[model samples]
Target chain A: MTLPILQLRAVGKSYGTVRVLKGVDLDVKRGEIVSLIGPSGSGKTTLLRCINFLEAYDEGEVWIKGQLLGYHSKGRTPQDRDSEAVIAEVRRPVSMVFQQFNLWPHMTVLGNVAAPLVLAKKINKTEAHRLAGLALERVGLAAKVDAYPAQLSGGQQQRVGIARALAIEPEVMLLDEPTSALDPELVEEVLSVIRELAHEGMTMVMVTHEMSFAAKISDHVVFMEAGRIVEAGPPARLFGKSATPRIQQFLKPWLDRSLSI
Target chain B: MNVSPEHIELLWRYINAMLVTLGVSLLAAFIGMAIGFLLNVLRICYPRQLSIPYRLLVWLIRGTPYFSQLMIVYFGLPVIGLTLSATQATVASLALYSSVYFAEIFRSGWNSIAPGHLEAAQAFGINRWQSLRHIEMPQALIFALPLLGNQTVLVIKESAVASVITLPELTMTTGEIVSATYDYVGPYALLILCYWLLAQTIALAVRGCATLLTSPQRTL
Candidate 1:
């Protein structure tokens, strides 16, 4: 049996006493596009963050290519947490594209994309720049390489964020509302890039509110609510005939809107 | 306007004192900026170890007046057998005083950086030091430029306070020239001109640096 590229076995997280993720079990096989659809505050973003150990889940295991991350055991104490170096090593195969397009304003497009490779992977400047150039080209941003992020439009800046994530050559890509921050006119450009990545068989777990886009591109659709997975299935099954009442109710507005459109 | 030749010659003789003033200011600014940079990094990255001590140092230095701090370093420390020369005491006190402000400048700069930038770095597997070097420091320094320029001028002006310790800096030399020549007006006027020119030069240099750091067309 082929192992999943990313796995979350009963993952759970909380802030103070408010539990955010309650036993989230998920697996993304290679060449899969899993779309996480949910209402606001449904822990979709938190789940994506936990996959790369960016948020540090307090319960269960996150396995990237079969290696556990962030903690050695289920223990949540400070002592039980792994060293930063170890955590980085385990999560190196995963990259994330954020909602805010957190491009460093001081850096040019090439510098922003090349920085991760140079700093994290120990790649030399020339080689990192070459890779960054290719990534930018893939995102249709080759001309903007010399431009500062502030000089670009919001759509263009988000493309730079995607290029930065792509330069690392990740095994799995996690996207947390990648197009939510863009203007309505600018959203299609970013969505097209994501759709292209999906067609190329990039393993992606994306949290999105764009129901139509998610339904069209996702191999698997997982609906979440109140920090739990209410339903999970193929796009056809989840969108055409969801078994759970909560997911049906949650997706009602989106489904109706898409139908009306 | 019967300006005496002796008075002109004495004023010219104070050039060495002006050099001494500039030298001490340069040294103090360099050392103080270095300390402030290290302290800010320590507080941000290793807060568990250095946060309390960092807060205490900022409070102690910023709470006291610069002159009093200078006196404490120059005179009070002698009680504990830590005696410094007049120049040494002046530089130390000035460095400590400026470091407090520099530290706050760096802290504010670092805080101004968007949280998303650091999050993106962490997601890419960049280590903490690498994140600071590649992402945080450049942007923070850029954000802090205007304030840093103001602090540089402040340091240069405060160097004049070294006159209290009998150090032959610019202000002390001007005082000496006036006392000997009995021409207070000429010597004081010349001193003001010299200081104004020095401040303007520093201001011009800082503007150049700010342009270099922040010019968007410069690229990476």
Candidate 2:
């Protein structure tokens, strides 16, 4: 019961010769918000993906609620990768929201949220729809359940994305630049939905460029650069005078925009 | 076009031949899609074991001419003690010939699905079977429909190749009528007309299915 909801130790991944995540470590306790902030191509999104085993962590261990993910043991050989059933079981408590709002284009908003419940959880359709309704209500999308993803505006589609993640009742949700794909005017609606979840004590790890929102909502802020965590701590430390000069330089633009710091 | 007794007889003969051709084409199309779907699934889920060999099989089938393939089915297999009736050989050969291209269509269909979609499915811990059925297959079918319509027309036309084995389908019947009356133009015209009508019917039907399957969720 004391274990952190999600744990990663020295996790590393390489796409052939290109190393995408290099020896990153972090812990997210229950009811915590950790925001990964970095420049483009700095592996923030890859690190979040590794937590769900969406991108395999080839070099280290990820423990979800005390169970190791991806591999059956410490061995990193291809043979050591766990079976699909095993990987699915280990990652069952995790869910993800995508930058592209990867809602199935062929499904209505209700169908999108209820899909994992039906397909992954094997719950009956009626019950799945009922739970999906609650999740949609949470994101204020209850009225749009019958609508298709493309029928909705960008912010509305991403809310459906959040509702899909929430419908699974995930122990932790990974958001890969949740608002990045939205038009500038539409970002706030999706962020408000996320802010509601944070207030309700949702455990989440988000990769975001929303400097002020991340500063406002995050309990722990991590600065990453070139595939490694460069600096991380409480928001005040990371956003204020104690930040590394490199991290400061990275935040300088947002700082000029006058972050809450 | 004056209505004559000989013309009525020719029209009747053409109708019977059209039925036979439809039977063969329909049977071949279904079998080809089933085999192609299975072969595609094998390569995707078991790439290390089956990918190279299946790719070679698909390539070999695609490269060979249909006429020679039909000859092999009709003549070559009998030499190895696998004899089949002429009609059986026609359907079997056409099915085998088209399955590889169907496999290619399926591969392209799956490839057209965004990587992000699969990643989201995986992140939810959707089982492999469920993911295939619910996530990948439906979307893939959307991409495959137009290609499938194309393959359907190709199979109908290619059934003409079965005339060499004397299966008595439309093309074979045309040859017989041509020889009997020395009337090349009328029987040939009937042959083209029958195939053109059949192919268009199927294409229209496939388009109907596409609309039915996609309309409710069709992004506005």
lDDT of model 2, residue A190: 95
> What RMSD does model 2 have?
2.8
Q: Write out the backbone clash pairs for model 1.
A: none
lDDT of 2 by residue, B1-220 (tens): 7999988888898999999999999899999999999999999999999989998998899998999999998999989999999989998999999999999999999999998888788878777787788888989998899999899889999998888888889999999999999989877887888998998899899989998877755321
| lDDT score at residue A45, model 1, on the 0-100 scale | 92
Q: lDDT at A206 for candidate 2?
A: 97
Show how many residue pairs clash in every candidate, following the order shown.
0, 0
Worst 10 residues of 1 chain B by lDDT: B211-220
lDDT of each: 0.89, 0.90
Off by over 4 Å in 2: A1-3, A16-19, A258-261, B179-184, B215-220
lDDT by residue (A1-261, candidate 2, tens digit) is: 577988889999999999998899999999999999999999998898888877888898899999999887678878999998899898888889999999988788999999989888889988999999999999998999888888999999999999999999988989999999988999999999999999999999999999989989999999999999998899988988754889878878888878455
